[model samples]
Target chain A: MLRVKSPQDLGAGLLFIFIGCVGLYFGKDLTYGSARAMGPGFFPIWLSWIINFMGAVCLVRSVTLEGDPIATIPIRPILWVSVGVLLFGYLIEHVRLELALLTLAVVATQSRRQTDLTQKIVAGFAILFGIAIIATRVQTFAFLKPFGDAVFGVSQWICLALFAIYALLTWGERDARQTVILSVCMSIAAVTIFVVLLGQAMPTYTADYIAPVFSKIGSIFSSIRGR
Target chain B: MDFNVFSNLMTGFVAAGTFQNIGFAMLGCMVGTLIGVLPGIGPIPTLAMLLPITFGLDPLSSLIMMAGIYYGAQYGGSTTSILVNMPGESSSVVTCIDGHQMARRGRAGSALAIAALGSFFAGCVGTIFIAGFGPPLASFAQKFNSPDYFSLMVLGLVTAVILAQGSVLKAVTVIIIGLLFGLVGTDVNSGATRYTFGISSLWDGIDFLPMVIGMFGLVEIIRNLEQESIERNPISTKLRDLWPNRQELKEASPSVLRGTALGSLLGILPGGGAVLAAFAAYTVEKKVVRNPSFAFGKGAIQGVAGPEAANNAAAQTSFIPLLTLGLPSNPIMAIMMGAMMIQGIQPGSAVMTSNPDLFWGLVASMWIGNLMLVIINLPLIGMWVKLLQVPYRLLYPAIIMFCCIGVYSSNSEPSQLLIMVFFAAFGYILMRFGCEPAPMVLGFILGPLMEENLRRSMVLSRGDPMIFMQRPISATLLALTACVVLLIVLPSFRKTREVAFQE
Candidate 1:
């Protein structure tokens, strides 16, 4: 009897076979016309079969051939990062972009093992303050006020504040100084490129605030041209 | 073979040589080099992120810029492979072997110089090949019917299966899964939904940008996080030592020529591209350099030069299949195809005839981009090397955030972010099983085309199953596909295939 050599292959084969079967099930109702004119199901049915054959081959190989065994998966990082992404998706719609970003940054960084706890606690509250200030500034801008209004309601602020405290209690252990700096630089560059230079629409402070600054710059350029 | 090519090229140069086009090309090269210098970020994700930005520019300028990024990344990837022993992209994996060894032996400057020079030479020749061959090939492909196209796609998929590393069975499985993913949208023929699972967002199919970001960018972050903190002491070499000596130059010249020739030829094949070219060239160099002055692994300039040249040559010539046949041989080319479609320019034989300026201008810009890469990279080597010192913890979050923004910017849809998250987990699971995702991406891009052609050919044959056999070109392509499959399945060739990839 051939012994199973690689659990990785076995899992992968099973997954592929499962997906192929699922495809077959779903595509069952679609038309499978004759060779003269293929219906919607013709290509998919053949593809599913091919997938099943390949998966079966993989399954057979898993028992017959020697291969690399599955490594120990890091569940912690996967879970935290996934939750972080989901949280961003949830919050971006409800709480708007800036708060979503803050939440994402705090949650995602939790995946990393932190050595210093005290510094992290300090950074956590400081980051919250910075976020609040930015949120207020965004609300102050004319064009961005609506977006900011939807995000900074009383209940949302309370929820974010509570989450901030929870983050401080459970997750705020890693040094985020460098992360903060990089995020700031990235946001600035993104705004400049996508907004200023390209004239593309993006969620930022506002075009009202941006227009006067650009107009002044444009005037300087026009004056140079005149000269 | 004709002055028509010269006249067309002159038109291209006149269009592409303007200051604005040159500036965009330079910008692309600079950004591409930065992306390549950073580990864990490859060309696919970078291109996907840049796709949105292309909307604002004219098609020709955007294409010129994106093309610059493609080859420029190849050049920068080699630098990282040589300096840090970390390949910034898959195509640079072969470079880490002897290139890093050379760096360790205090020959970093010579290795870097030869890599740059060999790549530049190969790029020039590759561009010339495009200028000479692209038009005729397009004309030839324009004559192909549906059966021929279907057979060619089949050949392309088979080649992808063969060229992919690891188990052949797994590669095929991944490709099949990719095809199924492609089937998730509405069926054009019967107007029936295949596998939307009642999700409205999935009705139009999974967005390519989100999938690519999740698969390559987010999955890489997760994988990097799984590792112990990345702490490596990069080799410190002086800028003055960047020049290769006369003896080294003499040794690398023949290898560069050989690699250029090999890569240029291989790159035209359906599944062959820079990664395969680099791997094949290195193997050839190992065999051809009968008496090596230095050990192959320790510090051989030939090893660096040959693969470097081959990869750059492959990067350039890989455009031929996409430009002429409207077929992408690899994932990078597939992403390029996506960029073209986004610009409302359909890629294929018609591209040359309908948009000759765009075609020739992109070709001409490749040479300028190559020139800019050498000029930009050599002086900026120190900056890139310094960039390598940034902590992975800081870098990962930035990458993720950038990906999030890039995806959101593409369609301004929150659901796309969720789609990205889904694929991120899915990609991670697949990676754990040792399945390469590149083949899957290629399959996803080619799936609809394959189906369209298959159905069209069948309809033309009036239910005759023997249509593929009746068409000479289709029959030949099918025969070639069979040979490839046989070569993979046969025990002796399978071992050689494994050895080639493992090397």
Candidate 2:
């Protein structure tokens, strides 16, 4: 009786049959005009019949034939990654969207393995938090005007230098260091080309729409270089 | 219907006759053949890429090039099947046995020559059918209301499932999944989102590029990756013969003729994809051919000649449903309709009367383009055969990277890459489970059409249940559908009855 061993077939067929019947019922509510002889419900009602019939055939075939044994389903990685995406969705309003997305990507990639769950989370958080700080300082200087700009600029340079050295030190152990580095480089390159060559203002992450730290830093660099 | 059509069609001939148009057709053939020879890539993306480039050209000229790519891909698929055991598309799989076996015996050259010859002959015959019969067919099409069209789509869906080589139930389920996937986007009439789950990007609906790239390009890469090796088996060194001898031709001729006829009929059916046509043709040929000395999986010359011709003929015939009814039978044709929309050309029955030049020109160009492919593919078979000699280790990485690029470029969205990765893994599991992807593809193509028709029929009938049985055409189709199901189930019923009586 097990020869027709397609569980996927059975599940899908039953689902269709159910949905088709629902569509058929919903279609019944509409008053189809006689202009075409068949009304709106005619199609779905007929389709549902076909679906039900097909489903029955499948069910019968599955019961009558000796099909291959069902195998175990893979659930962990798909679910874990889905959860990470949900978390990213939740964090987008508070954290920068790019940072949130990056964190999601990192955590999802890491969660594929069983042992690295804790370590992956710690690394993910550290990266997200670190980027958040840079964006915050960038937001601060732009909002506070001229006096705050110079102060933030000096601090950002020092912080950037420190982070670069720290990143270099950590680059040896993590394969994701490459992705992070590429991400940083690509973001900087795109921002630079857009602001300088294209003459567009960078959109700020802060509520007040303060210019991004990179733009202020670029302006400062330009003024200093002009001197 | 008017004298203007004659002038317009003549204008179409002029448009197609130019050096520029001819060059475009030739270029499309060359490009199409190369991509077709590569396993895993198909015509849609290649044609989509060419679509934008056609913006500057006359509409007829651009369409001719696209037609060239469409049929060129069909002919190109056989080349890969002949030399390597791999087929770029599901339909081409039938060609692999004899084609590669012919290659193994150092007659790869002859196998290829015959395939190309059969394809060219069928393409010519099919083109004649399209040219002479297209208008009459298009006129005859007006009597079809939405319900009848919908019923026909149901018939197509049933044909896909029953004819497919897997469990019939699985085919139905896979088709339903495809329909659900189609329903994942925005609701056109209600403006109510169906299944986007609040993702704004999905508000427009499931993108065709991602679905196609995921199911086709990604799945193939994953399957290839799972294999320990995907190298071409070694062939004999002599490899001198290039033409089919009398005995070979004698065996292949009937199969080719039979395949052409089957493909012509099946190709016109909605949801009847090229792969389905090929498989159907192979089954018919197997049933009819006496002695059929070569088993299906072994080197059978009939296997190569029939399916190749059938698939190409079917690929051409598929255009009839799309051009006449504005219904795209497959995703590739759907993309073509998108291209037509981009050009502000409506694809429905109005197109025939409104733009005879464009319509007739496109039809005529299909014949010309097929001829171009034959002339183009024959000499280049030697070049393609040399490509099979490349090592698999070198080839797999390059193929995988190309797959990644192809998936990425289809929509310029990295999300598709992710989908591809997931589907690739899923595809491997499908292969392991002995589930064929061909039926799934056919279902995917037909699902939405089936739903649309069913809805249209019910709507037209004013909620009356008996509309399907009342219409002669619809009744005939439904009865035929019932007959097919009964034919499949009757033997099982008898067997069960015997068992019950024995007890």
Candidate 3:
């Protein structure tokens, strides 16, 4: 039977109240000792009560005063972005950093679809790979390097990513053939950065069955170079 | 004893002047400028995003980098405002007014120069102010008992509520809720965990990185993405003649001086101090300047200089309360406090005596960082302006990728990502309800400390409530708090505050 003049205020009031109740309910079990011998619950309980009182005041104000209406919230952006982030998060340790990054960009683009889908896909994957390479320090092929195990510098990996980003981004007005070429260039740069620089232990890719084959291939190449 | 400031600074310079620290400081500045020039990102998210990178750094080096980022971001924000009329940071919003107008009227060079020079002068003065005042304040803080500390926090929280943007009541509730959130995790006194929901990660309390990145970083990206077309068309600025003319300089100097003085004082207060300082300086300049080459909004150099100086000065001095009293006056300082805690160092008066090198080194690095901003950013304005053309569609995904890697790499646990998702959703909901999540962070940081001090005070008083009134420091702080509360409730002050924000 209560009329809400300001939906924003009303919603905020309800949220504050709910938050207070959660605090109170969860903290109920802890002993609320006297002030002189205060227990864990003492301060929290006091704070929760104050929050509840504030919420009640907000509720009264919501009905009594004129205020702003709640603005319409766009759900697509938040949903797609969140989905993309979560996908990257869960996929990083399993699928590897590169694929996870690619998945994130692909998912995020779904929030606002455009006719330049091919370009979007290319730029998104390119820039994201650049960021991923920077985020987790690139691997140094310390064990397999031809420099008698002496590795190159770490800065080159970042430069590789940076170059890939600039190359693909500037070619946005071009056709898909160029996009593919740029993408290939970026991938080669990424692999070289990971393999040729001071290595980090970050997993770039991981598949249970294919892991043995890659390591086997690496061992064979190292053995061939050792002679 | 007063002469010790020089020796202290000498030590600070020696410690922070190392090539390693300088390199980190410059790196932080460059990264910070890149983040700040990009619209839709603020210092809070940028700081949260870059926090993981500093994990491998020495405490002093990390703090230096963080401070560099803070100042560089603020400076970069001003540049964006001058060049594009899009205020990249909140404190630079007023700058966009006359600053962009100056650009439109072909005095963009003058505007940028005045702002940069004014900010440089302000930053130097602020650093000196900290050097002069920090020790005295810390020494005085040493005299504070548990009750005094408790009262000080109460005063801080009250003032923060008053100074925060939007409704007074709502802000109060938000802070209270934050305090409650801070109470989650294990209680130091009792060794019992509260509100963890049986999760192992909750035993250590909520992780700061996930909460911050989720709330500020992720939410920001989502908000930016919501706009139909995130196209940015920056005004083409000619940076060839970057010096201000004699007349423009002469006009802006006095206003800059006034702004620096006003800001240094206001910055010591709690909550949104820099933002308020900028806003207040604009009002002061309007009243003080007798005439202008153009109208106030029509490219007045005084309008551009005063607020820019004030905000930079405020940003520097806002560290006073956090450094001396171990209280975070704003959310930004709260993050600093969190960083210090993560580094296993507690911020307080003791830091001056116990970790003199780190304290003075940090203070010295601030000056170096400011110098770096002026030197590095002036030449790089063209590069930053070009960055404005990078489409937002490409930017957001990169930002998200960076955030996820930072968060995951920091803890390397899957649950941390889940925590981020939770905070992002919570922040999004709060945004819809017109409730800010910023003040909550301040409260959360203070929560456990306040409880510990409060409980100790109660014990010292033998359960008597009047002990707070008996102590001089406590009583004075309480009195100040009462005055602030009265100011908030008063109709006249409220009207003025409303008018101030309206401009």
Q: Give one digit per residue, the lDDT tens place, for model 2 in B56-152.
A: 4567776887788877776777777777677776667778766888777677778888888888877877766565556666776677776667666
Residue A205 C-alpha lDDT in model 3: 47
The residue-level lDDT of candidate 3 at B49 comes to: 75
lDDT of 3 by residue, A1-227 (tens): 77888888899999989988998999899999998899999899999888889889889989998889988898778777776777567556655666555555555555665345444653464454444433443246333343321112332343244335434554554432243343344434433433233132345643334568998999999999998
Interface root mean square deviation per prediction:
1.8, 8.4, 3.3
Which portions of model 3 show Cα errors greater than 4 Å? A114-201, A205-227, B1-3
Over 4 Å off, model 2: A1-64, A70-227, B2-12, B18-20, B39-66, B234-240, B245-255, B269-303, B327-346, B391-460, B492-503
Q: Rank the candidates by DockQ, best first.
A: 1, 3, 2
lDDT of each: 0.80, 0.60, 0.80
DockQ for model 2 equals 0.08
- Tens-digit lDDT string for candidate 3 (B294-371): 889888998999999999889899999998899888777888888888888899999988998999999999899989
Candidate 2 chain B: 10-residue stretch with minimal lDDT: B393-402
B356-459 per-residue lDDT for model 1 (tens digits): 88999999999888888889888788888887888788777666766776777677776788798888888888888988887788788778888998888888
RMSD of model 1, in Å? 5.5
TM-score preference between candidates 2 and 3, better one? 3
